[model samples]
Target: MNTLLLRPDPGHEKFGLGPFFRVEPLGLEYIGAALLAAGYPVTVADLRFRPGATAWVRRTTPRIVGISCLHALEYDRIIATAAEVRRAAPNAFIIVGGHAAASYPAPLEHDLIDAICLDDGEEVLPALAKAIKKGLPLTEVPALRLKTDHGWVTTQPLPERTSLDLIRLPARHLVERHRSGYHCLLFKPVWLVETARGCPHRCSFCSVWQFYGRTCRERSLAAVVEDFATAGDSIFVADDLFWYDPERSMELAAALKKRGVFKRWILVQTRTDLITKRAEVMAAWRPLAKDFDIFLGLEAASDSGLEGITKDSEVTDSVEAVRLARELRYGINGNFLVDHNWGEAEFQELWDFVARHGLQRAGFTVLTPLPGTEFYEGIKARIPDQPWSNFDMHHLLWEPKLGAQRFFELYAETWKRSILNTSGEKSLLDWVRQVKPSQWPYIIRVLWQTQRMMKPDAYMTEHALSRAPLPEPAARQPGAIVRDEGGQP
Candidate 1:
């Protein structure tokens, strides 16, 4: 039996350009690699890199077509692409998985998608292929949602893979086949690798814990090093919290060094608390630091706002992490969740903090209550809109405690202030200076991109607020309607 794994094109929208704009569909790669390891013929197509995906689908012709829906914004496009694929391959089994599908299985249970993989697809996908090869009904597979006579029938949970080391490195052949015109940051070909799954921290605003569960899982050091070897010059470890285990991180770093994979730069994300407590561990792994960039989620400026989001990392801890990263001479990037509950004063506080710490290469996202998160449940009673696209965190979906217009204005103003701050600019220059002078062109390109993002008028005009009135909570659908075992509805 032949199987084709598809990653739907994430439609053109916010930040859909530059290094950050690249689509690295590691989920589809994981499932495809697993199926291939089991001796099943597999083809993977990332729609983002494919022109006229519907036309490409008509050409591939496979028995089973699996589409990954990584982000909610890609829902409309996925549905349309699935419909087109069904038309081309009438007998094809269309399967949908990923964060969006895992969160909201009920809505996607319609005729467009034949089967939904609820949890990890690495194990389930191979079993699905075997069952198909043997001409067995898909209902026998665990962690699957399929259409029954009545409606959707979901099977018992597929047991999570106990050993992360068992999963193979993603099928690089698939990535290369469709990689002629791909985008990456810094002009270098970039590939994504996963060191672990699930996050140990339970940040209230994040849906990772809800989807992947709370416990952290790590791949064997040898397994991770082997995977890193297959990637390109740059690798992004797409773990929710990369350094959750300092000992494991050090061991992995040493292993990478031993295997010579440390020569390629690696980017990873971690919490502020981890960075502070593990500075020595990070220093021990300094051989890899020149090629390493770390992203920290310092969500809020004030402790009250931090508590609201259940980010236990104190403001002091965040500042310390920034200081430590600078001392260790590592590229540092941060993402801050601007609370809508704050007025001008709070926005000023955030700007002041950023300037004081010289955090230039940072992202400022509006505090959106994304579906399947505790924050979403807490604010369901007062949410103002159903514009799902606005849930992208770039737009303000709720009627802010400070009111909508002011919220947007303050957000725009804060972005401008943070960009123009002298201290922030100097700090970025310090980082650039650490790199070889020959790489200045690439560094300048990224800086230009950052400046474009910082432009107030450009961003405001592009992501402007609609003048429509806010919707009443009573008029909105209940939260349960949009939620399922996998994740958001």
Candidate 2:
């Protein structure tokens, strides 16, 4: 059996944090590993680089093609890539899977796609390939939404959650050619390592918990230690919750130290409450890297705001976490959600909070009702014709209470308060000096591209171009008090 896995060029990466991060497709690498172990020849191509899917398909001539859809914003690009693959390899059984595809697959249920993997690909893809090789009915394969004469219908669910130990090591060799292209901020050639999967917390704005059913699964200590030992010096841990289990995290830190594993830089995401409650665990892991940064889910500025979104943690937790992490010498970079229903007062409150805590590193995003969440289910009917590209959290799906223009004015001002605003506290030249002369070109290019986020006109243009006409009631009744969905007004 021959297999081809692709990480498509997500077309909507020109805005927000897109330029700041571009790591390898760790999911496809793991799936490719499983296929290789099962005696299938595999080729992993990141279509973000030169030579698109058509070129790879012509060269590899694969029997099966798998495409990843990690974010909802990439839905359009994924479909276009699938069409291109179909043209190049008409006989290939095309399957799509990843966070977005598996969560709400309705958008990807097209004639070009043969099936969608609704679960972990490491187990599902190998099993799917085996059935295809044997000419067996794909309906027998578990965890798939298979295409049939009738229509797209899901097959049986996996007997149990796939173990993290399914593949001893990811098939990173497949993506080695594009290693230097992978990065997070100034860390070129960075490695993405996953010590765990799934998040236990249920933040209403997030889809991770809803998709994974609030279950947290960790890899074996030995496996994690081995991964860290062999990986590059700069690593970004892909865990949704880095310290969900304090004891296991502490043990993992100890195991890495025992194996003599250290890094130049490491970045991980976790909740402020987790940091405040599990201070000892965080302390234990701080020494793993010379430059350790923690990305906290600082979702709100006040207790009422946090409660409205069901974050379950208080604003005090965020304050304390920032204090504690800085005390421990861990660089802090977090984000806060700016609600569409917010007024001038609300925006000012967030600004005051950021200034008070000295959190210029924190980023801001509009409160988007992402697919695969309860929030999206409640609000999808309101905006039926909006393009998926606008779901990037930078664009508003519906007109806000303050209207698009004023909302973007305040939104852009909020961004100016952050360190990303080159015209603000940090000059473009200062950012250039931080990196080596060789990296200046890359740094300047990324910083210049990021300036679009600071322009209200840029967002307004994109919003008008991508959005459909507003609903009749909302349009007829301007300046009406629109109740906020999934949060307080």
RMSD values for the candidates in order, in angstroms, are 5.9, 2.8
lDDT of model 2 at position 346: 84
Candidate 2 C-alpha lDDT tens digits along 74-171 = 88889999999999999999999999999989999999999999998998988888999898999999999999999888999999989897665888
Find the 10 residues in a row with the least total lDDT in model 1.
Answer: 475-484
Model 1 C-alpha lDDT per residue in residues 120-213, reported as the tens digit of each score: 7888889888988898887888888887777788987866644677777777777786553443444345677888888867777677887776
lDDT values of the candidates? 0.70, 0.89
Which stretches in model 1 have alpha-carbon errors above 4 Å? 16-19, 178-184, 380-385, 418-469, 472-489
